[model samples]
Target: MSTTKWSIDTAHSEIGFKVKHMMFTNVSGNFEKFDASIETEGDDFTSAKFDFSGEIASINTGNADRDNHLRSGDFFDAEQFPTLTFKSTSFEKESESDYKLTGDLTLHGVTKSVKLDVEFGGLAKDPWGNTKTGLSATGKINRKDWGLNWNSALETGGVLVGEEVKLNIELQFIQQ
Candidate 1:
């Protein structure tokens, strides 16, 4: 078995999330800058480790006002917490190409353990002769758990934002 190191292809990868807004609509956004590193021993990812970091100031939701609000003390508090990070503690193979990755996720000012449902898309050689790998992961977490509790109660019912935030990650990596 050969040992390999992989680096995330930022240009072809995305880190995004969606949350229920005003109890009726879904607001989604993506981080423009993030990177991850993976180390593994052959096909068995048991010994693999992962580290990822994202810039909080690069958030884009297609709306400037919303973006600013997200960056303020109401949500991410980007000025106080300049980055969000994740470091894998363990990875369990659920199937031939699926895994459950458990790790520490840090956001806002709190850190908590989270599990991500990961799908390994296998490996292939690109047209340019470079070997690459693909992966997709998703998870959900309650924003309130991370201390992001700003919200407004609607006159009719429900809150301005949902507590649960759905996270989605699509990644492509180049073998190094």
Candidate 2:
């Protein structure tokens, strides 16, 4: 079989995350600008090669102040490390509609191997006759592991930000 290429449909995809704030409520955010690509043998994702990236400057959490703070040296330091990236090392099918995706995630100048759970959302053809596939992936990572250790001690006794960040990604790829 020959390799097939797929490019992300940005309009239908999002790279989002959630983290606990003040040891209580969860704060949600997402990158407004991002891109991804995948290459596989035909339509089999079990041995696919995936590459994804998100610009630090595009981080949006609804509040301008917080977004600016995240781009500062205390967190992502957008000036020094402008983008976070991921390159897959393995893609293994776990079931009919589920798979395990392992990759090297580079963020805040640090690179670490991370694993995510992926659910295949099947495929479909658009009105334009373009073939597309959808995927939903979830994962968790410790911010400190990627050198995003900035935090403040809350007056109420807990920390201002949680260490663990939950990843919630939705991807739509157009076959090319």
Candidate 3:
């Protein structure tokens, strides 16, 4: 196998999530610290080895109180978990620039298989002659499945936080 190694360009990547807040609007946040890598057999990403992890303490929502609470036992419990991670199990190409990636995602002390839809952004050459590529991955997971069950019954009717969490990952990798 002609395996090629690539490292994530952190400055060009972001890991973000959104969930329904209350029942009307959605609250979004992102992890400020994350790392990922790619190991492919060739130029084609049809099948590749991918892995990633993000610091739980780096959760940011533009609100310090909520961020701190997310790092607490009521949510991520950063002291005990410290980080969230994903290790790919399968990577299947959908047509030309589309793909489906299945992996094990661990969060808040629980591990579960999840799938992400990927859109390849193609490869390019940087000003310094480095080979770089970009892609966007999207997925959804039920927060309760990962033990993040903290919630409150709103007097309006529904719970405070929604169960489904949407994940958005924008990644750029430089060929190593």
- lDDT to native, each model: 0.91, 0.96, 0.93
> Model 1 reaches what TM-score against the true structure?
0.96
Order of models, best TM-score first: 2, 3, 1
Model 1 off-target regions past 4 Å? none
TM-score of 2: 0.99
List TM-score per model, in order. Answer: 0.96, 0.99, 0.98
lDDT of 3 by residue, 19-137 (tens): 99997889999999999999998787877989999999999999999999889999899999998999999999988889999999999878999999999888999999999999999
- Compared with the true structure, the alpha-carbon lDDT of candidate 1 equals 0.91
Candidate order by decreasing lDDT: 2, 3, 1
Give the Å shift of residue 20 in candidate 1.
0.1
Candidate 2 clashing pairs, residues 3+ apart or interchain: none
Best by lDDT: 2
- Candidate 1 residue lDDT tens string, 140-167: 9999999999999999988999999999
For lDDT, candidate 1 versus 3, the one ahead is: 3
In terms of TM-score, the best-performing candidate is 2
- Candidate 2 residues 1-176, lDDT tens each? 99999999999999999999999899999999999999999988889999999999999999999999999999999999999999999999999999999999999989999999999998899999999999999999999999899999988798999999999999999999
